[model samples]
Target: MTTGNDTARTTVVVVTWRGREHVTACLDAVAGQTRAHRILVVDNASDDGTAALLAAHPSRPAVTRLGTNLGYAGGLAAALPDVGTEFVAWLNDDAVPAPDWLALLEDALDKDQGAAAASARMETAGGEPISLGVTLTADGHGADTTDTGTETTGVFGFCGGAALLRTEALRRVGGVPAEFFCYYEDTDTSWRLRLGGWTVLPVPDARVVHRHGASSRPGSREFHRWNERNRLYMLIRCAPAGVAARECARFAALTAVLPLRRLAGRNLPPAWNFRTGLRVQVLTEVLTRLIPLTRQRRAITARAVVPRPVVWSSANPPR
Candidate 1:
């Protein structure tokens, strides 16, 4: 890939929370990237020998072990201020990118000055495409693009697990919201970038093999709660009226029916009932937090060059 400017320095950040079996290989792949990048490992106070493993890894990335778990968004927030590089690439501990991933992403970004970030195609180790780019739903859920993924696909934004973000764009948007702490951070950033008049590009040729449950296991009660909690929060804080209204109705409908459904379904597990209650609690959380993030939302939306509908549709993608 051609280095468009003198500031070609790329810093790769990998955040892990008790990712013992995953961090080593993640670092190895980062070190093997076609571009010589400065790798940084942010450990969320992992006691699972992740800290020790990073110390022993051959890559020798700059490691920061926080005193407590600040979640993925917070970890990046803590590290971004100190990042002097032109671009910051994020790779979760459980995800490993192909050698040319960084090169391909940079090339795509260099060709389009409006692009705030570039994303890699995420896939399972077995070659199943996990997600191409985000396709946001009115229900406050983001669909992972899984079909006809071309080499130069454009998207609303890149997933947090495998993305290269421009440093200046992050700074302009106040960085990723640490308040989100975990889920929805990526989607929030995507919308902010779009609203801030920047494009988000997706590069299909750049592939990453991701282990889905290394940090937050899917289908667990905690996973469902955070996902539900964050999804509502995102809709409230940043989503446009149409999206938010749709999600509100969806939540309302579910809340109204779950009690009756639970009564009729005798075979439903205890965990099922518990997660259902958690979803309602998610609504309360969203309402409570919405007031505080409203100012930020207004500020973001006020700068919109890319409208909500265009972003949702990924219209006029970069050539």
Candidate 2:
């Protein structure tokens, strides 16, 4: 049941690591898309025969192989130069899209000219809905919504795993920040889109099922390290100077209070791991502030189409 309009509009880019099985499942789901999309599987040096699996799908979407692991940002960036469509949809190798996902995203962007990117409802493997977008609280925390069937405003950011970005908007933002090898790349890019006067929308009609934590080992060192470091990096790179300072204060307070909260629950090992990771993140930020912060400041100040007040207020409110 291939739809007639599938060939011309969208290009789907899937980035994969060492998840050959998951990548195969993801590609099968993409092959089931109703609205026809050009597919590109960017293999990030998977040792698990990922390239061979992609090669087997020659009759479907095209495949691009990177000789080395470039991480999420690098893999997607490598695919950008070859994308020749109106919309580019990013799908993680460990996620499977619903049959109508492409159609739904296309419909949302078609109706809103200002939409720079649109995301579908992301669900867990067991069908529990994941919060793909949310409104930001004053302290940089997000309020998740359960109304998974309605269009919403004020979607602060989206997961790169399952989102459709306007080609022109992506071009304007100058593509994903390759400096961010993995985590928070989506947040950084989304903020840049908003600052450039483009809107990011979340379309509930579209959906994808993600196998959470499949790519990384649970409670592993790399998992904790990258998550903490990238979280801080994203906050620093995206927020205005005053807002960034406020967020840093809020985050520090939260970290200091975590041990007290954990006293009632989880064991000491995870707690100690978290505290150590936080310390490492803080030290890394202090050591590298001169270079990354200077670059971030230049980027934000140069193309600031939106007012600082709007950006700041959007992030913070009277509590």
Candidate 3:
């Protein structure tokens, strides 16, 4: 079922950490892509035989093995420098895309010269739509957009799970903020793309079924720690001044008040016993890194092609 159009200009980069179970199937799906995408697997120091499996796979995707367990963002950061493709598409090791997934995404970007990235419509194994793109929450956290009705629409961000990014656009934004490690990295980059006057679009026809949390289980302490901390980092680096300041103030206030409320035996938010501690740690970490964060914020501001107000206003456009 190959598309006659040439697709050698695109590279599929899959980042995996201890993903022995799904790497084979993931690669198989990539191999079946209607367009012949060059495949690459970035192994994040997985000692679980995942590296060996990839090496032996018949399709023989080029492998880059990092010595340390740099998270997904780090994995991409490592591989992206070596990627000479016009486009780079990331497919999670645990996700399997439709046969025509790459073809459709490539088509979308080909048609829209202004779009820096195109997000895929992702679903669960049972065919439940899970993510279309990213929508900024009222609290400034990144959440997935689940609108299935749109064929293609402007979005604030792309999900790292399944998205095709223009190589030059990505390099211009500094190639996937490796500082983020994993969580919210894509959203942060999306913000950068928008600020640089590049559009992010959702292409619902390009589909991927992801086994969410296959690498890091949601709600786990590790997940919350990185997720919470990274959200603040992303806001500080990419959000408008008013939005960043307000969210940071609220976070600090919550950190201070939540402990007192618990001591008073007031009913705390469910699952917040640990969250209070997480907030404190996140606040401290952000403060410790404030100098670097401020530098990044200034850098983003200096290179921005679109005004902050305009980017923030379109964060969650009317469906």
Candidate 4:
């Protein structure tokens, strides 16, 4: 069990793109936390005067502004060197945590020495639950949804918007992959932690409300492109060889089935996105495979402390 001092030791890391209003609300919530904590805001080259606004705050956290937009993975990597605490909490600029959010996550970590990361329950700005529970089948392919106040064990991955991670575990597996600019970065990191003999879970009591797509316009061309590219990257890097094959087959089957199903239901936009995503997936795979180093793949394989078969079975189950 972690001691009292360990529980008190934490640093909050927030990554922002351009949502100044949402970012301000997020910081206000963190400032209201009961537990003593430090905050780090990594601004990803926002031209909307985010730096000026953060500078004007009374009790400001340490802010770092990257001249170029590094996207999600790059912003996380930038804040890593600045994280001096034993535990690090990641919050999206658009997410607001409950007052006792920090305390609950800290307690959850204290309860288990093997806990690598603990994510809080997430709800949408409209009060609908957003992200809380995640279940990956024996294969890396899986889905996530908001939980209904029920505790879950052995989570496949966590939402990067509101998750607390042990610094040592992150260090052991290396930081978040830079290749994943936006989506699936958390899944990649979580897979690494699990393979390194660490556990990730959901803390239902801790809550955060997120304004989805607050940073960018949803369903825009760029949004679809990034989401499409990153999802395929995640399957390649995290899934076991056999599991990847199965997921690929499943994905192909879905591409054929979902479009027709959506069209039948008169949902044109989704069907379009699905078809576009398939094309993007093919291009990304070809480009990524051409690279010789495969740095992310090599890093994951080298630091894996768990047996390949065990990790595979744990992440993928019999269908």
Residue pairs that clash (backbone atoms under 3 angstroms), model 2:
6-35, 6-36
Q: How would the candidate models be sorted by lDDT, starting from the highest?
A: 3, 1, 4, 2
Q: What's the CA RMSD for each of the models?
A: 4.2, 4.0, 3.0, 4.5
- Residue lDDT tens for model 1, 1-319: 2112235478888889998988888888887888767777888999988888988887677788899999998998878876788888878889989999999988888988888898788999899988777767645586567665534456666788999999989888768788777877888888778777887887888999999878886777766677777777666666777777687778767777777777888455566324467767767777777678677667767666666666655532344
For residue 205, give model 2's deviation from the true position in Å. 1.3
lDDT of 2 by residue, 140-215 (tens): 5434444544364447666677999998789877687776677667777777787788877888768899887787
Tell me which residue pairs clash in candidate 4: 138-316, 138-317, 139-316
Comparing candidate 1 with candidate 2, which one achieves the higher lDDT?
1
Worst 10 residues of 1 by lDDT: 1-10
Ranking by TM-score: 3, 1, 2, 4
Top model number, TM-score: 3
Task: Tell me how far the alpha carbon of residue 32 in candidate 1 is from the true structure, in angstroms, after superposition.
Answer: 1.3
Candidate 3 collision pairs: none
| Candidate lDDT (C-alpha), each | 0.77, 0.73, 0.85, 0.75
**lDDT for 257 (candidate 2):** 66
Q: Which tens-of-lDDT digit does each residue in 1-319 have in candidate 4?
A: 2112334578888889886777889988998888878888888999888888888766566888899998878888888887778888888899899999999999999998888899888887676777875556544544575655336445766778799999878978878777667766787788778888888878877889988888767677666666655655665665565665566566666656765776688555453356746554655563656343255666678888885568667765556
Which is better, 1 or 3, measured by lDDT? Answer: 3
What is the model-wide C-alpha lDDT for candidate 3?
0.85
